[model samples]
Each structure stands twice: as C-alpha cells, then as structure tokens.
Target chain A: MYGGGGGHYDGGGGAANANSLFGGGGFMPSQSTAAPESSGGGSLSKVGPERADAAAAHREADHGRGAASDDKSNFAINSVEVSTIRLVGRMLGKVERVTDVAFILDDGTGKIDVNRWENESSDTKEMADVNDGNYVIVNGGLKGFQGKRHVVAYSVRRVTNFNDITHHFLHCIYVHLELTKSNSRLPSQINASTGIPGHANQVRLPNNQATTFSASGNTAGNDVSSLVMSVFHDPAIIDREDGITVAYIIDRLKLPEEVIKEVMQKHIDDGNIYNTIDDLHYRSAMNG
Target chain B: MDTSSPAAIVNGEILNKFVGRRVRTVVQVQRNEGGMVFGQSTDGHQLTIKSAMDIPVSHFMEVYGIAEHNQTIRAEVCTDFGPNFDAKAFDGLCKLANDKFKHLFL
Candidate 1:
C-alpha cells in the first residue's frame, strides 16, 4: 500500500494524509453526473468486511517484520475476538520447486513459507493462488519451518471482490513503483490507495526505487499518474462551485483560479468530495 | 515528571519570529478564557509575544497543556481524524520522518 505523491498548486499546505484530506473531508461517494457511469470510472462503496479486515492486518504487517507477530489480514486479534488469521502477498518461488507443494508467500511483511503436505488438492492452487500481481487473503495456522516462519492454510481468497460500490467510494491512493516489475518477483508491496510505500513492501525494492513513493516529488505537480484510487465521496455536500479552497499561506494567495476550476465542478454541496489529488504549491518560492 | 514547567520543544512561528527569547520548551501558558493575556515567564518559560492576539491561527500555537494525569505531554484532542500529531513531540520528529510515531507526519 504505497507510492502516490500528488501535485501542488501555487501555495502548498503541509498536509500528511493525517491532516490534509481529499475532497474537503467528505466520507461518501459523489453521484451527480448527467453522463454515463463508466465515463470517469470509480468505486462507490466503503471497503468490504474482508478487505477491511485485511487492511487493518495490512497496517499491522507493515514494513516487513516476523510472521508470528505479522498479523496482516487477521487484525481484529487485538481488538476483535477471533482465530485463524489472514495474510496477503505473492508466492515468491516454488518452496521446493513449483509442484513440491511447499513455498514462501511474501505478504509484504516477511516470507511465510506455506505447506499443505497432507491435503495437496490439484485444483487448490488456482491461477489466483500463484498469480503474483494481485492481492489475496489467506486463512491458516502457524508453524515453524527450517527457521523461517510458515503457515499451514486450509483456504485462500483473492482480492477480486470488486463491485459497483467500489468505483465511487475512494479511500486511498496506492502506487505500483514501476521498477518493482524488473525483478522476477517484486519484493516490495505497493498500496493501491495511498502512494506511500511500506517496509513490508520495501524489503524487495531495489535501493534507488525505494524512495519513489510519498516524499519523492521532483515529479512536477506530484500527480497520481499511475496510482489506483477509489471514488467514495458523496458529491451532494461538497461545494466545488466555489472551487477547491486551498489556503495559500506563503504569499497569502489562495489556490489559483484555474487549477481549482480544472479539477472540481461548480456548485458542489458541503459533506462530500474527499477524493482529490490536485497538489498545492506555495505562493512564494521560499523553500523551493 | 517535574510539574514546575512543562519540558517542551518549540517549533512554532511564535517562538521563532516574534520572540527573540527562543523558547526551547514552554513550561506553561496561563489560560483564562478571559482578559487579553499578558505573558508570564522566567528564564526558560519566557516568550516574545506577550499575547496571542497578534498571531494567526496557522502562525500561533497553544498545542499543549500540562497533562494533569501523568505529566506526559499529549495531544489536546484524541481523534481518529485529521493528522493526529502529538504537538509536544513535534521537535523530536526529524524533518525527514524516520520513526514509527513520525509516520504521522508523512
């Protein structure tokens, strides 16, 4: 879940995703277009239970740590009551060759060598099981293997749970660092929502490509060029008509008239519109 | 745990631009919800601006208050919303953001 440094206008505000929010801080999706639905294509619902569960686990399993403590998909362990943890990542290499039935699955955290010795069903490891690019959630029990951490799972699920709700309810920005593809297996993981790279995914990144996510912004406007985003805000509340009001503290000059008009529509209501990536720059080039 | 004066790190514009005093840490601010404030300070507690009247919202700060509980300086509000920066620790966080807590900055 990483890599998405957005663009800036003429007076940038110091906003970490912590403070500065997109679309004026609304929490729903915008649905007010006369045009066809697929025109600007985006999701409209909140992330579902399983994906949300994985997201929490993903936050815990951030930046490559040990497997026992790496609660990637089974996050509610601390807050919620449950067993059978969930995990997500790529199947690195055949543990003992492609059909040997045992291998390491890198869940952005550390490699979790998985093995199903007793019940190796021929159809179990489908295209979804070994497919490297997509995200998946696996449920299983932990066991030690050759000093490396391992999980003996009875089941696995893919992250293809996309639906009509997904296209409009945007929550984050995840960037797929272009360079990760060079290696036979991209070691690092990229957040499809926020371009901010995590250590779980950082372990496999080639050195030079490591810093390309959040802070690496020589890229003009810091645009989310190839990043993935969800359109989750309700447009009825955001008043984009007044345009995106960016407070320019440098020269006290607000967002330029053109930049705001370019991205937002007019007469936006007030409670939705938090899925923007337009960057804000300083009026005076003090730091630049 | 000395309640005498809060050990603070000043990163605000008020201390830098206005006060030549250079508040390395603010021991405390006298909050009244009344009367235009006249400053009170000794050696380490001294501030440049006698009052918060002149500072802008972004320019000024009243970020911390002595934690009556354990004396550990914490955030004014606990929230799962907007950047949850514990204002007191702002100085300890490097400009480059290199720690778990510092990720809140990024």
Candidate 2:
C-alpha cells in the first residue's frame, strides 16, 4: 500500500475500497460509485452472537471512562487503530548497518526510533542518501526489543511535498476522530439496520424531524448542544470545512471542558451533530 | 483526570509510562503467532500481544497488558468480539464519511 500510493492515483482505478483512509476522500467524485451491495446482509448475519458481545464490551469500557476522559485515541496517528504506524517526520539521527537502518524521528509532538530491515534490493542503495535531517515518511510495525519502543519501517520515502507533513498530521487526527468518536458510537436505531460496524450506514430519523436535538429533558445539556452548534455558524470557524476542534469550541463557548465533552457526547449519541473531520472537531449532522 | 484538553498520545509516547503499570487499550491484530500476536490501535500504532492461545484478527479485542520495554505488552487479559466491526457504535462515523472530505459537505 505504501509504494503503490503514487501509481494508484495515476491509474485512476475505480475504488473498490472507498473507505480507504488516504485514497477516497471527498476529493474524488468516483467515491459514490463504490460497491454499496457489500454494505448489506449476508456478511453481518455470519457474525451473529459474537458481534453483540463485543458491542457490549466496547460500550462498557467507554462508559466506564465516563464523559471526556482524554480517550487516548484522541491523537490522529494513535487513532488509526492499527498495529502498524506510518509516520512522516524529520530524521534526528540515523545509524546504518549492513542489513538494517535505524533512525530517531522527532515529529514535534514526540520522538521515536525507526528501524528498517534492509532486504537485498537496489532500494538499499537509495537509502544510503537518507542522512540525518532529511524529512522522510516511515511505514513499519511497532517493535519493542530490549525495553524500547521502535518503528520497524518496511518502507521509507522522502516527502517531496513539505505541506504533506502538516497535512498528514491533520489527516491522521481527522481520520482517527472520525473512527473513534463518530464511527464507533452509532445510534441503536441505525445499528439495528446494518450489521457491519459503521460503514456508510444511515439511521433513519423519524419523518422530516431532521433537527433531532430535542429537549431530552436535559435543558442545560440541550443549551450547550445548541451553543456548540452555533459556533459553526460563525463564518470564521465554520469556514474551514475541517470543523472546529473541541479546544476551539471550549474557548468560544466558555464552558468547562468536561461539560463541553459531555454535551458533545450526548449530541453524538442522539445524532444531533456529527463529528466532522475528527472527533475533537465537529459539525452539524443536519447537513449530513 | 483533567478534561480541559484532548489527552491524545501515540502508543510510543505512553510506552514508558506503562512499563510496570497495568494499562488497557483497544487493540487490533496485524499478525498472529501461536499464543502471541502483533497488534496495534485501529490507527495502526504497534504493540505486542502475548496470550496462551493464538488470537486471530477476526476477534475484536480489548487488551490489558503490563507495559514492558522488550515486548511492550504482555497481554494479561483479552475480551473478544465475534465480528470484526462494531456497527451500532460506528454508524455515525460512516455517515460522516459518506461524503468525501469537503467543507461544503459539512
């Protein structure tokens, strides 16, 4: 997937996997043509009872965390929820061995060591030029040997687009929030329809009752929800389609972070507003 | 826990903190060996998993591990899922993603 990134776009292939994090952003018009039939039946029925048990456990853990507990998946890269991480950062240092390459990468937030096991290929010669201070993206599995966290990079490439680093950070966060907050917490109404975990499934809200942010007997909660939504109306914040981060919402609403988190969670549960780019950032589901 | 900001951290950032502590996080499998697995967050941050039995990726799992440097995590406990994806919990995510990433889509 790493090496094919460039050629995949050039080939203009019909995206069989439209849900691909990197490829199928709204940027492409072909996304709608992705196979919708797969979104349906037989596959879900097979999982049966096992799926239910997992659902219960996931909810239990989430509820136990209560409202707004940093929810570790909050970071973008951390949120991809994969066993392997693909990181793009500046190389702080490097140590090259006959059979492997190791480098320390500082992505500004933190630093981690990346180790690349060299296979006999012409590619090994190309890596020799990857000296310290070179900005490169490393894709590898996480390995811990001798009490240290290291990225075992299977592929490392120099990033030609400088903006891609910043974009990668934001994109990682965006996808993570979308996956963790919005994707994992589907309303029961919608959950009943599709058996697959949140893949383009829609919860049919009651007829024409698009604005479901009703007074669910919690006036304060409803007020905060409205306030949260109102901020998007401000051209400045809403203008950036990425939506506003929870921090920005906290600043503008002048509400306690916990209170804001609780309100936001409630809205997501009730389907009032949906997480836009990332869970920390959000926008109204009305448009969705 | 302070809720003032999003306390998001990469698995690497928190590895040292969990060295001797009992910590829990949701993990997805990338590879499996008899009684051990290479797992990561849904986002692909890596961690090691050790168990008495070979656990496949199909099982949705929540793992508790004692963070160690050499192995990162020795899976002390695991909760399994019969199905891979949790639809009820993730529908909002799919709906939000229905449209590609676009400002107007919001």
Candidate 3:
C-alpha cells in the first residue's frame, strides 16, 4: 500500500530483450516461504546523497588509476564484461535449483542469473531467504557459459528501500559519464611547487576549453587545470542529480568539443572523473 | 498522447529550452524532501521539482511544471503513476524503468 503520488503502475512489457540466460525452467530451489526480511524502506532517506559523497571520496583515493580493479566486484548493470562486477535488482522468478540454485536478477536495463552454490559457506542463509518480487543487491563476478551471462555471487542482500534502485542507476550514469568525458593531460609541475600530495595527478584540466585563464607562462597548463576544476565545482552544474555531460559544458561555457575532450581526458588521467554508462557523459570527481 | 514515446530532450540541454515554459514530462523521483524532489528524466536529464504536493521516492510522474532558473522546475501539477497509485497505466512505465535504466549503473 505505497502512497504519495496518486497514480497507477503501468509496466510496459516491451523492454529490449534482457540478456537473461534462460527463458524459463531450470531449477527451482526449495521455496523459503519466509516473509521477506524487510527494513521498511529505511534506507530511502539517506542513500541517494551518499552516492555523490562516496564517489567523491572514491575519486580522491584512486586519482591515478585507470579502473577500480581492486574494487572490481563493485559491478553495475552495463558492466557485463567486467569479471569483477556487483549489482542490485529485483528477483524475477521463483528460485531455480541446479548444482547451485539460481535467481534471475532484473535491473530494468538487463538481467543476469545469480547463483548460490550449495558448496559455498559464504552468506547463503541470507540469500536463501530472498523472495521473488523483492529488491536485492549482489556482489559477484560476471561469467559466460553457453553464450549467456551469469554471476557467481559473493554476497546478496535484500533491498529494503526502493529508492536504492534509482540511486544505483544514477550512480551508474555518473560513472559512465566520468569515464568517457574526462581526458588526461600531461602531468603538471604545479603540484611540486604547491606541495599538494599527488597534486600533479589531481590537477585535471579541460586543457582546450580553459582559455579563459590565458596567461602565457610555463604555468599555463596549471591554469587550464584550475579552470576545469572550476567547471566541476560550479554549484549550478554540480547540483543536477543527473550529473553533467560534455555537451552541457561545451554549451554553457562556450567551449569547443575538442577542448572539452582534452580536459575530460585530463580529468580521467588525474582520477578526477571516469567514463559513465557511455563515453559522452561525465560527473565531477567531488560528486563522483 | 503516447506517454511511452522516447523523450525528445535526452539530456540537460532540454532544460535550456524548457525554462519559463509549462511543460509535461515523465520523471523518476530520486529524492523528495521539504517541498522539493530531485529526479532524472528517462532520456538522462536532471530535474528538480518544487511543489506543494507530496512526491514519493522511486516513483514515476507525468509532471506539468515550469522550468525555473537552472535545472529546477516549479511544479504546477504532478500526476503519479505506479502499482500503489494508478495501477491501470503505470505498470508499463515502472517495468520500462527497471528493464532499461539499469545500465545507468556502474
């Protein structure tokens, strides 16, 4: 009996064919019939904002890395090829049992089979209790067998608040944009002069678009980096929940795309931003 | 009107055109508090709603509002849709979000 907006649920069945492995019938686990262990949507209030805050911290800590490989299990829906992937979604069907019980997880955009092997001593009890039509977060590696994608879950937890689903999707969009839009620049010498730890790596500049601070000197590159940082820190740009895009930067700052790309590359190099769902999108490292 | 059609404004640039105009669009509520709700449109634009109405999190709405300064909108009216709200029409919207939008995740 959820209420607030007085409308109806219209689930259009026409989704792009989800990358689900099976159409139906594989293995049905012994049904847990347990009333879902719910937290009454308590996480709803706080989860959304935490994404930006945490992403900011994540960017700061891994300023020079190409990917968060060490945290590879932190998977999202589009990360199907990344072996170390983690995700959360709704359970689509009755638990299926084979050598290991499998639960089909649907996260709107895609679907993947998550297996809970009988052989493992990891958190099986909690996963076993998850019911169909409930939300869940899974941590695991992506796998391919017989041309289908599968996930061998390291952990699965019931999602109490529905907001987490939206939050997860937004986070994904944020990452995709950051990964694709920001570019790396030649490491600047300003860090040594300013004494900021990893400052060269931290100085991500939209080198081409940052002509506003044009002062001819060896420090021109550093000024460009500062300009790019200003773009990210702009409250009007940062406040949007959808994050920022390269096109938006180009239009708002009257900067050229080539210039934007260079700054984006610089951001990527400094770990200030990473590509989001695709290459064109980006968010600030501070709000990563 | 087909509410299911893909939004023309796929990104933030749409906001520039909508400012000062009363427009109708579908949005998925990300957070709502203190007479304001932050949301993202299906085509990938950020939306901030300021309204006297109560807006719930994780629900979709066919919102008629005026785009104020920045990415924010001052809502004139918001029509909610989903399982607990309008069961007749929102099932498709809800399903579409869960199926396609998941890729936005990392």
Highest-TM-score candidate: 3
How well does each candidate superpose onto the true structure, as a TM-score? 0.23, 0.31, 0.33
> For candidate 2, what is the lDDT?
0.40
Residue A114 accuracy (lDDT) in model 2:
72
All candidates' lDDT scores?
0.26, 0.40, 0.40
All candidates: DockQ: 0.01, 0.03, 0.03
- Sorted into a CAPRI-style docking class, model 1 comes out as incorrect
Best by lDDT: 3
Superposed on the true interface residues, model 2 gives a C-alpha RMSD in angstroms of 17.3
Q: What is the TM-score of chain A alone in each candidate?
A: 0.27, 0.39, 0.37
RMSD over all Cα atoms, model 3: 20.7
For model 3 chain A, the run of ten residues with the poorest summed lDDT: A1-10
- lDDT for each residue of candidate 3 in A1-288, tens digit (9 for 90 to 100): 000011101112101111111100011000111112221211111111111101210011111111122333321211111233335555766475644667776543345567866554434455565788666665444444443345676455665433444334444333333322221212242222322234335433222112211111224433444455455545455545556677777776566789877866645543344344456666543331
Off by over 4 Å in 1: A1-83, A95-100, A117-129, A161-288, B1-106
Residues A74-145 of candidate 1 have per-residue lDDT tens digits of 222111211222344345454444443565554321345566443344334432354443333443444333
- List model 3 lDDT by residue over B28-96, tens digit each: 777888878887765556878789267578777545566675477787656564423332223333333
lDDT of 2 by residue, B1-106 (tens): 1111111222433445546655444456667888777766544457677772356675545555566663466766564532444322222222332233211011
Superior candidate under lDDT, 1 versus 2: 2
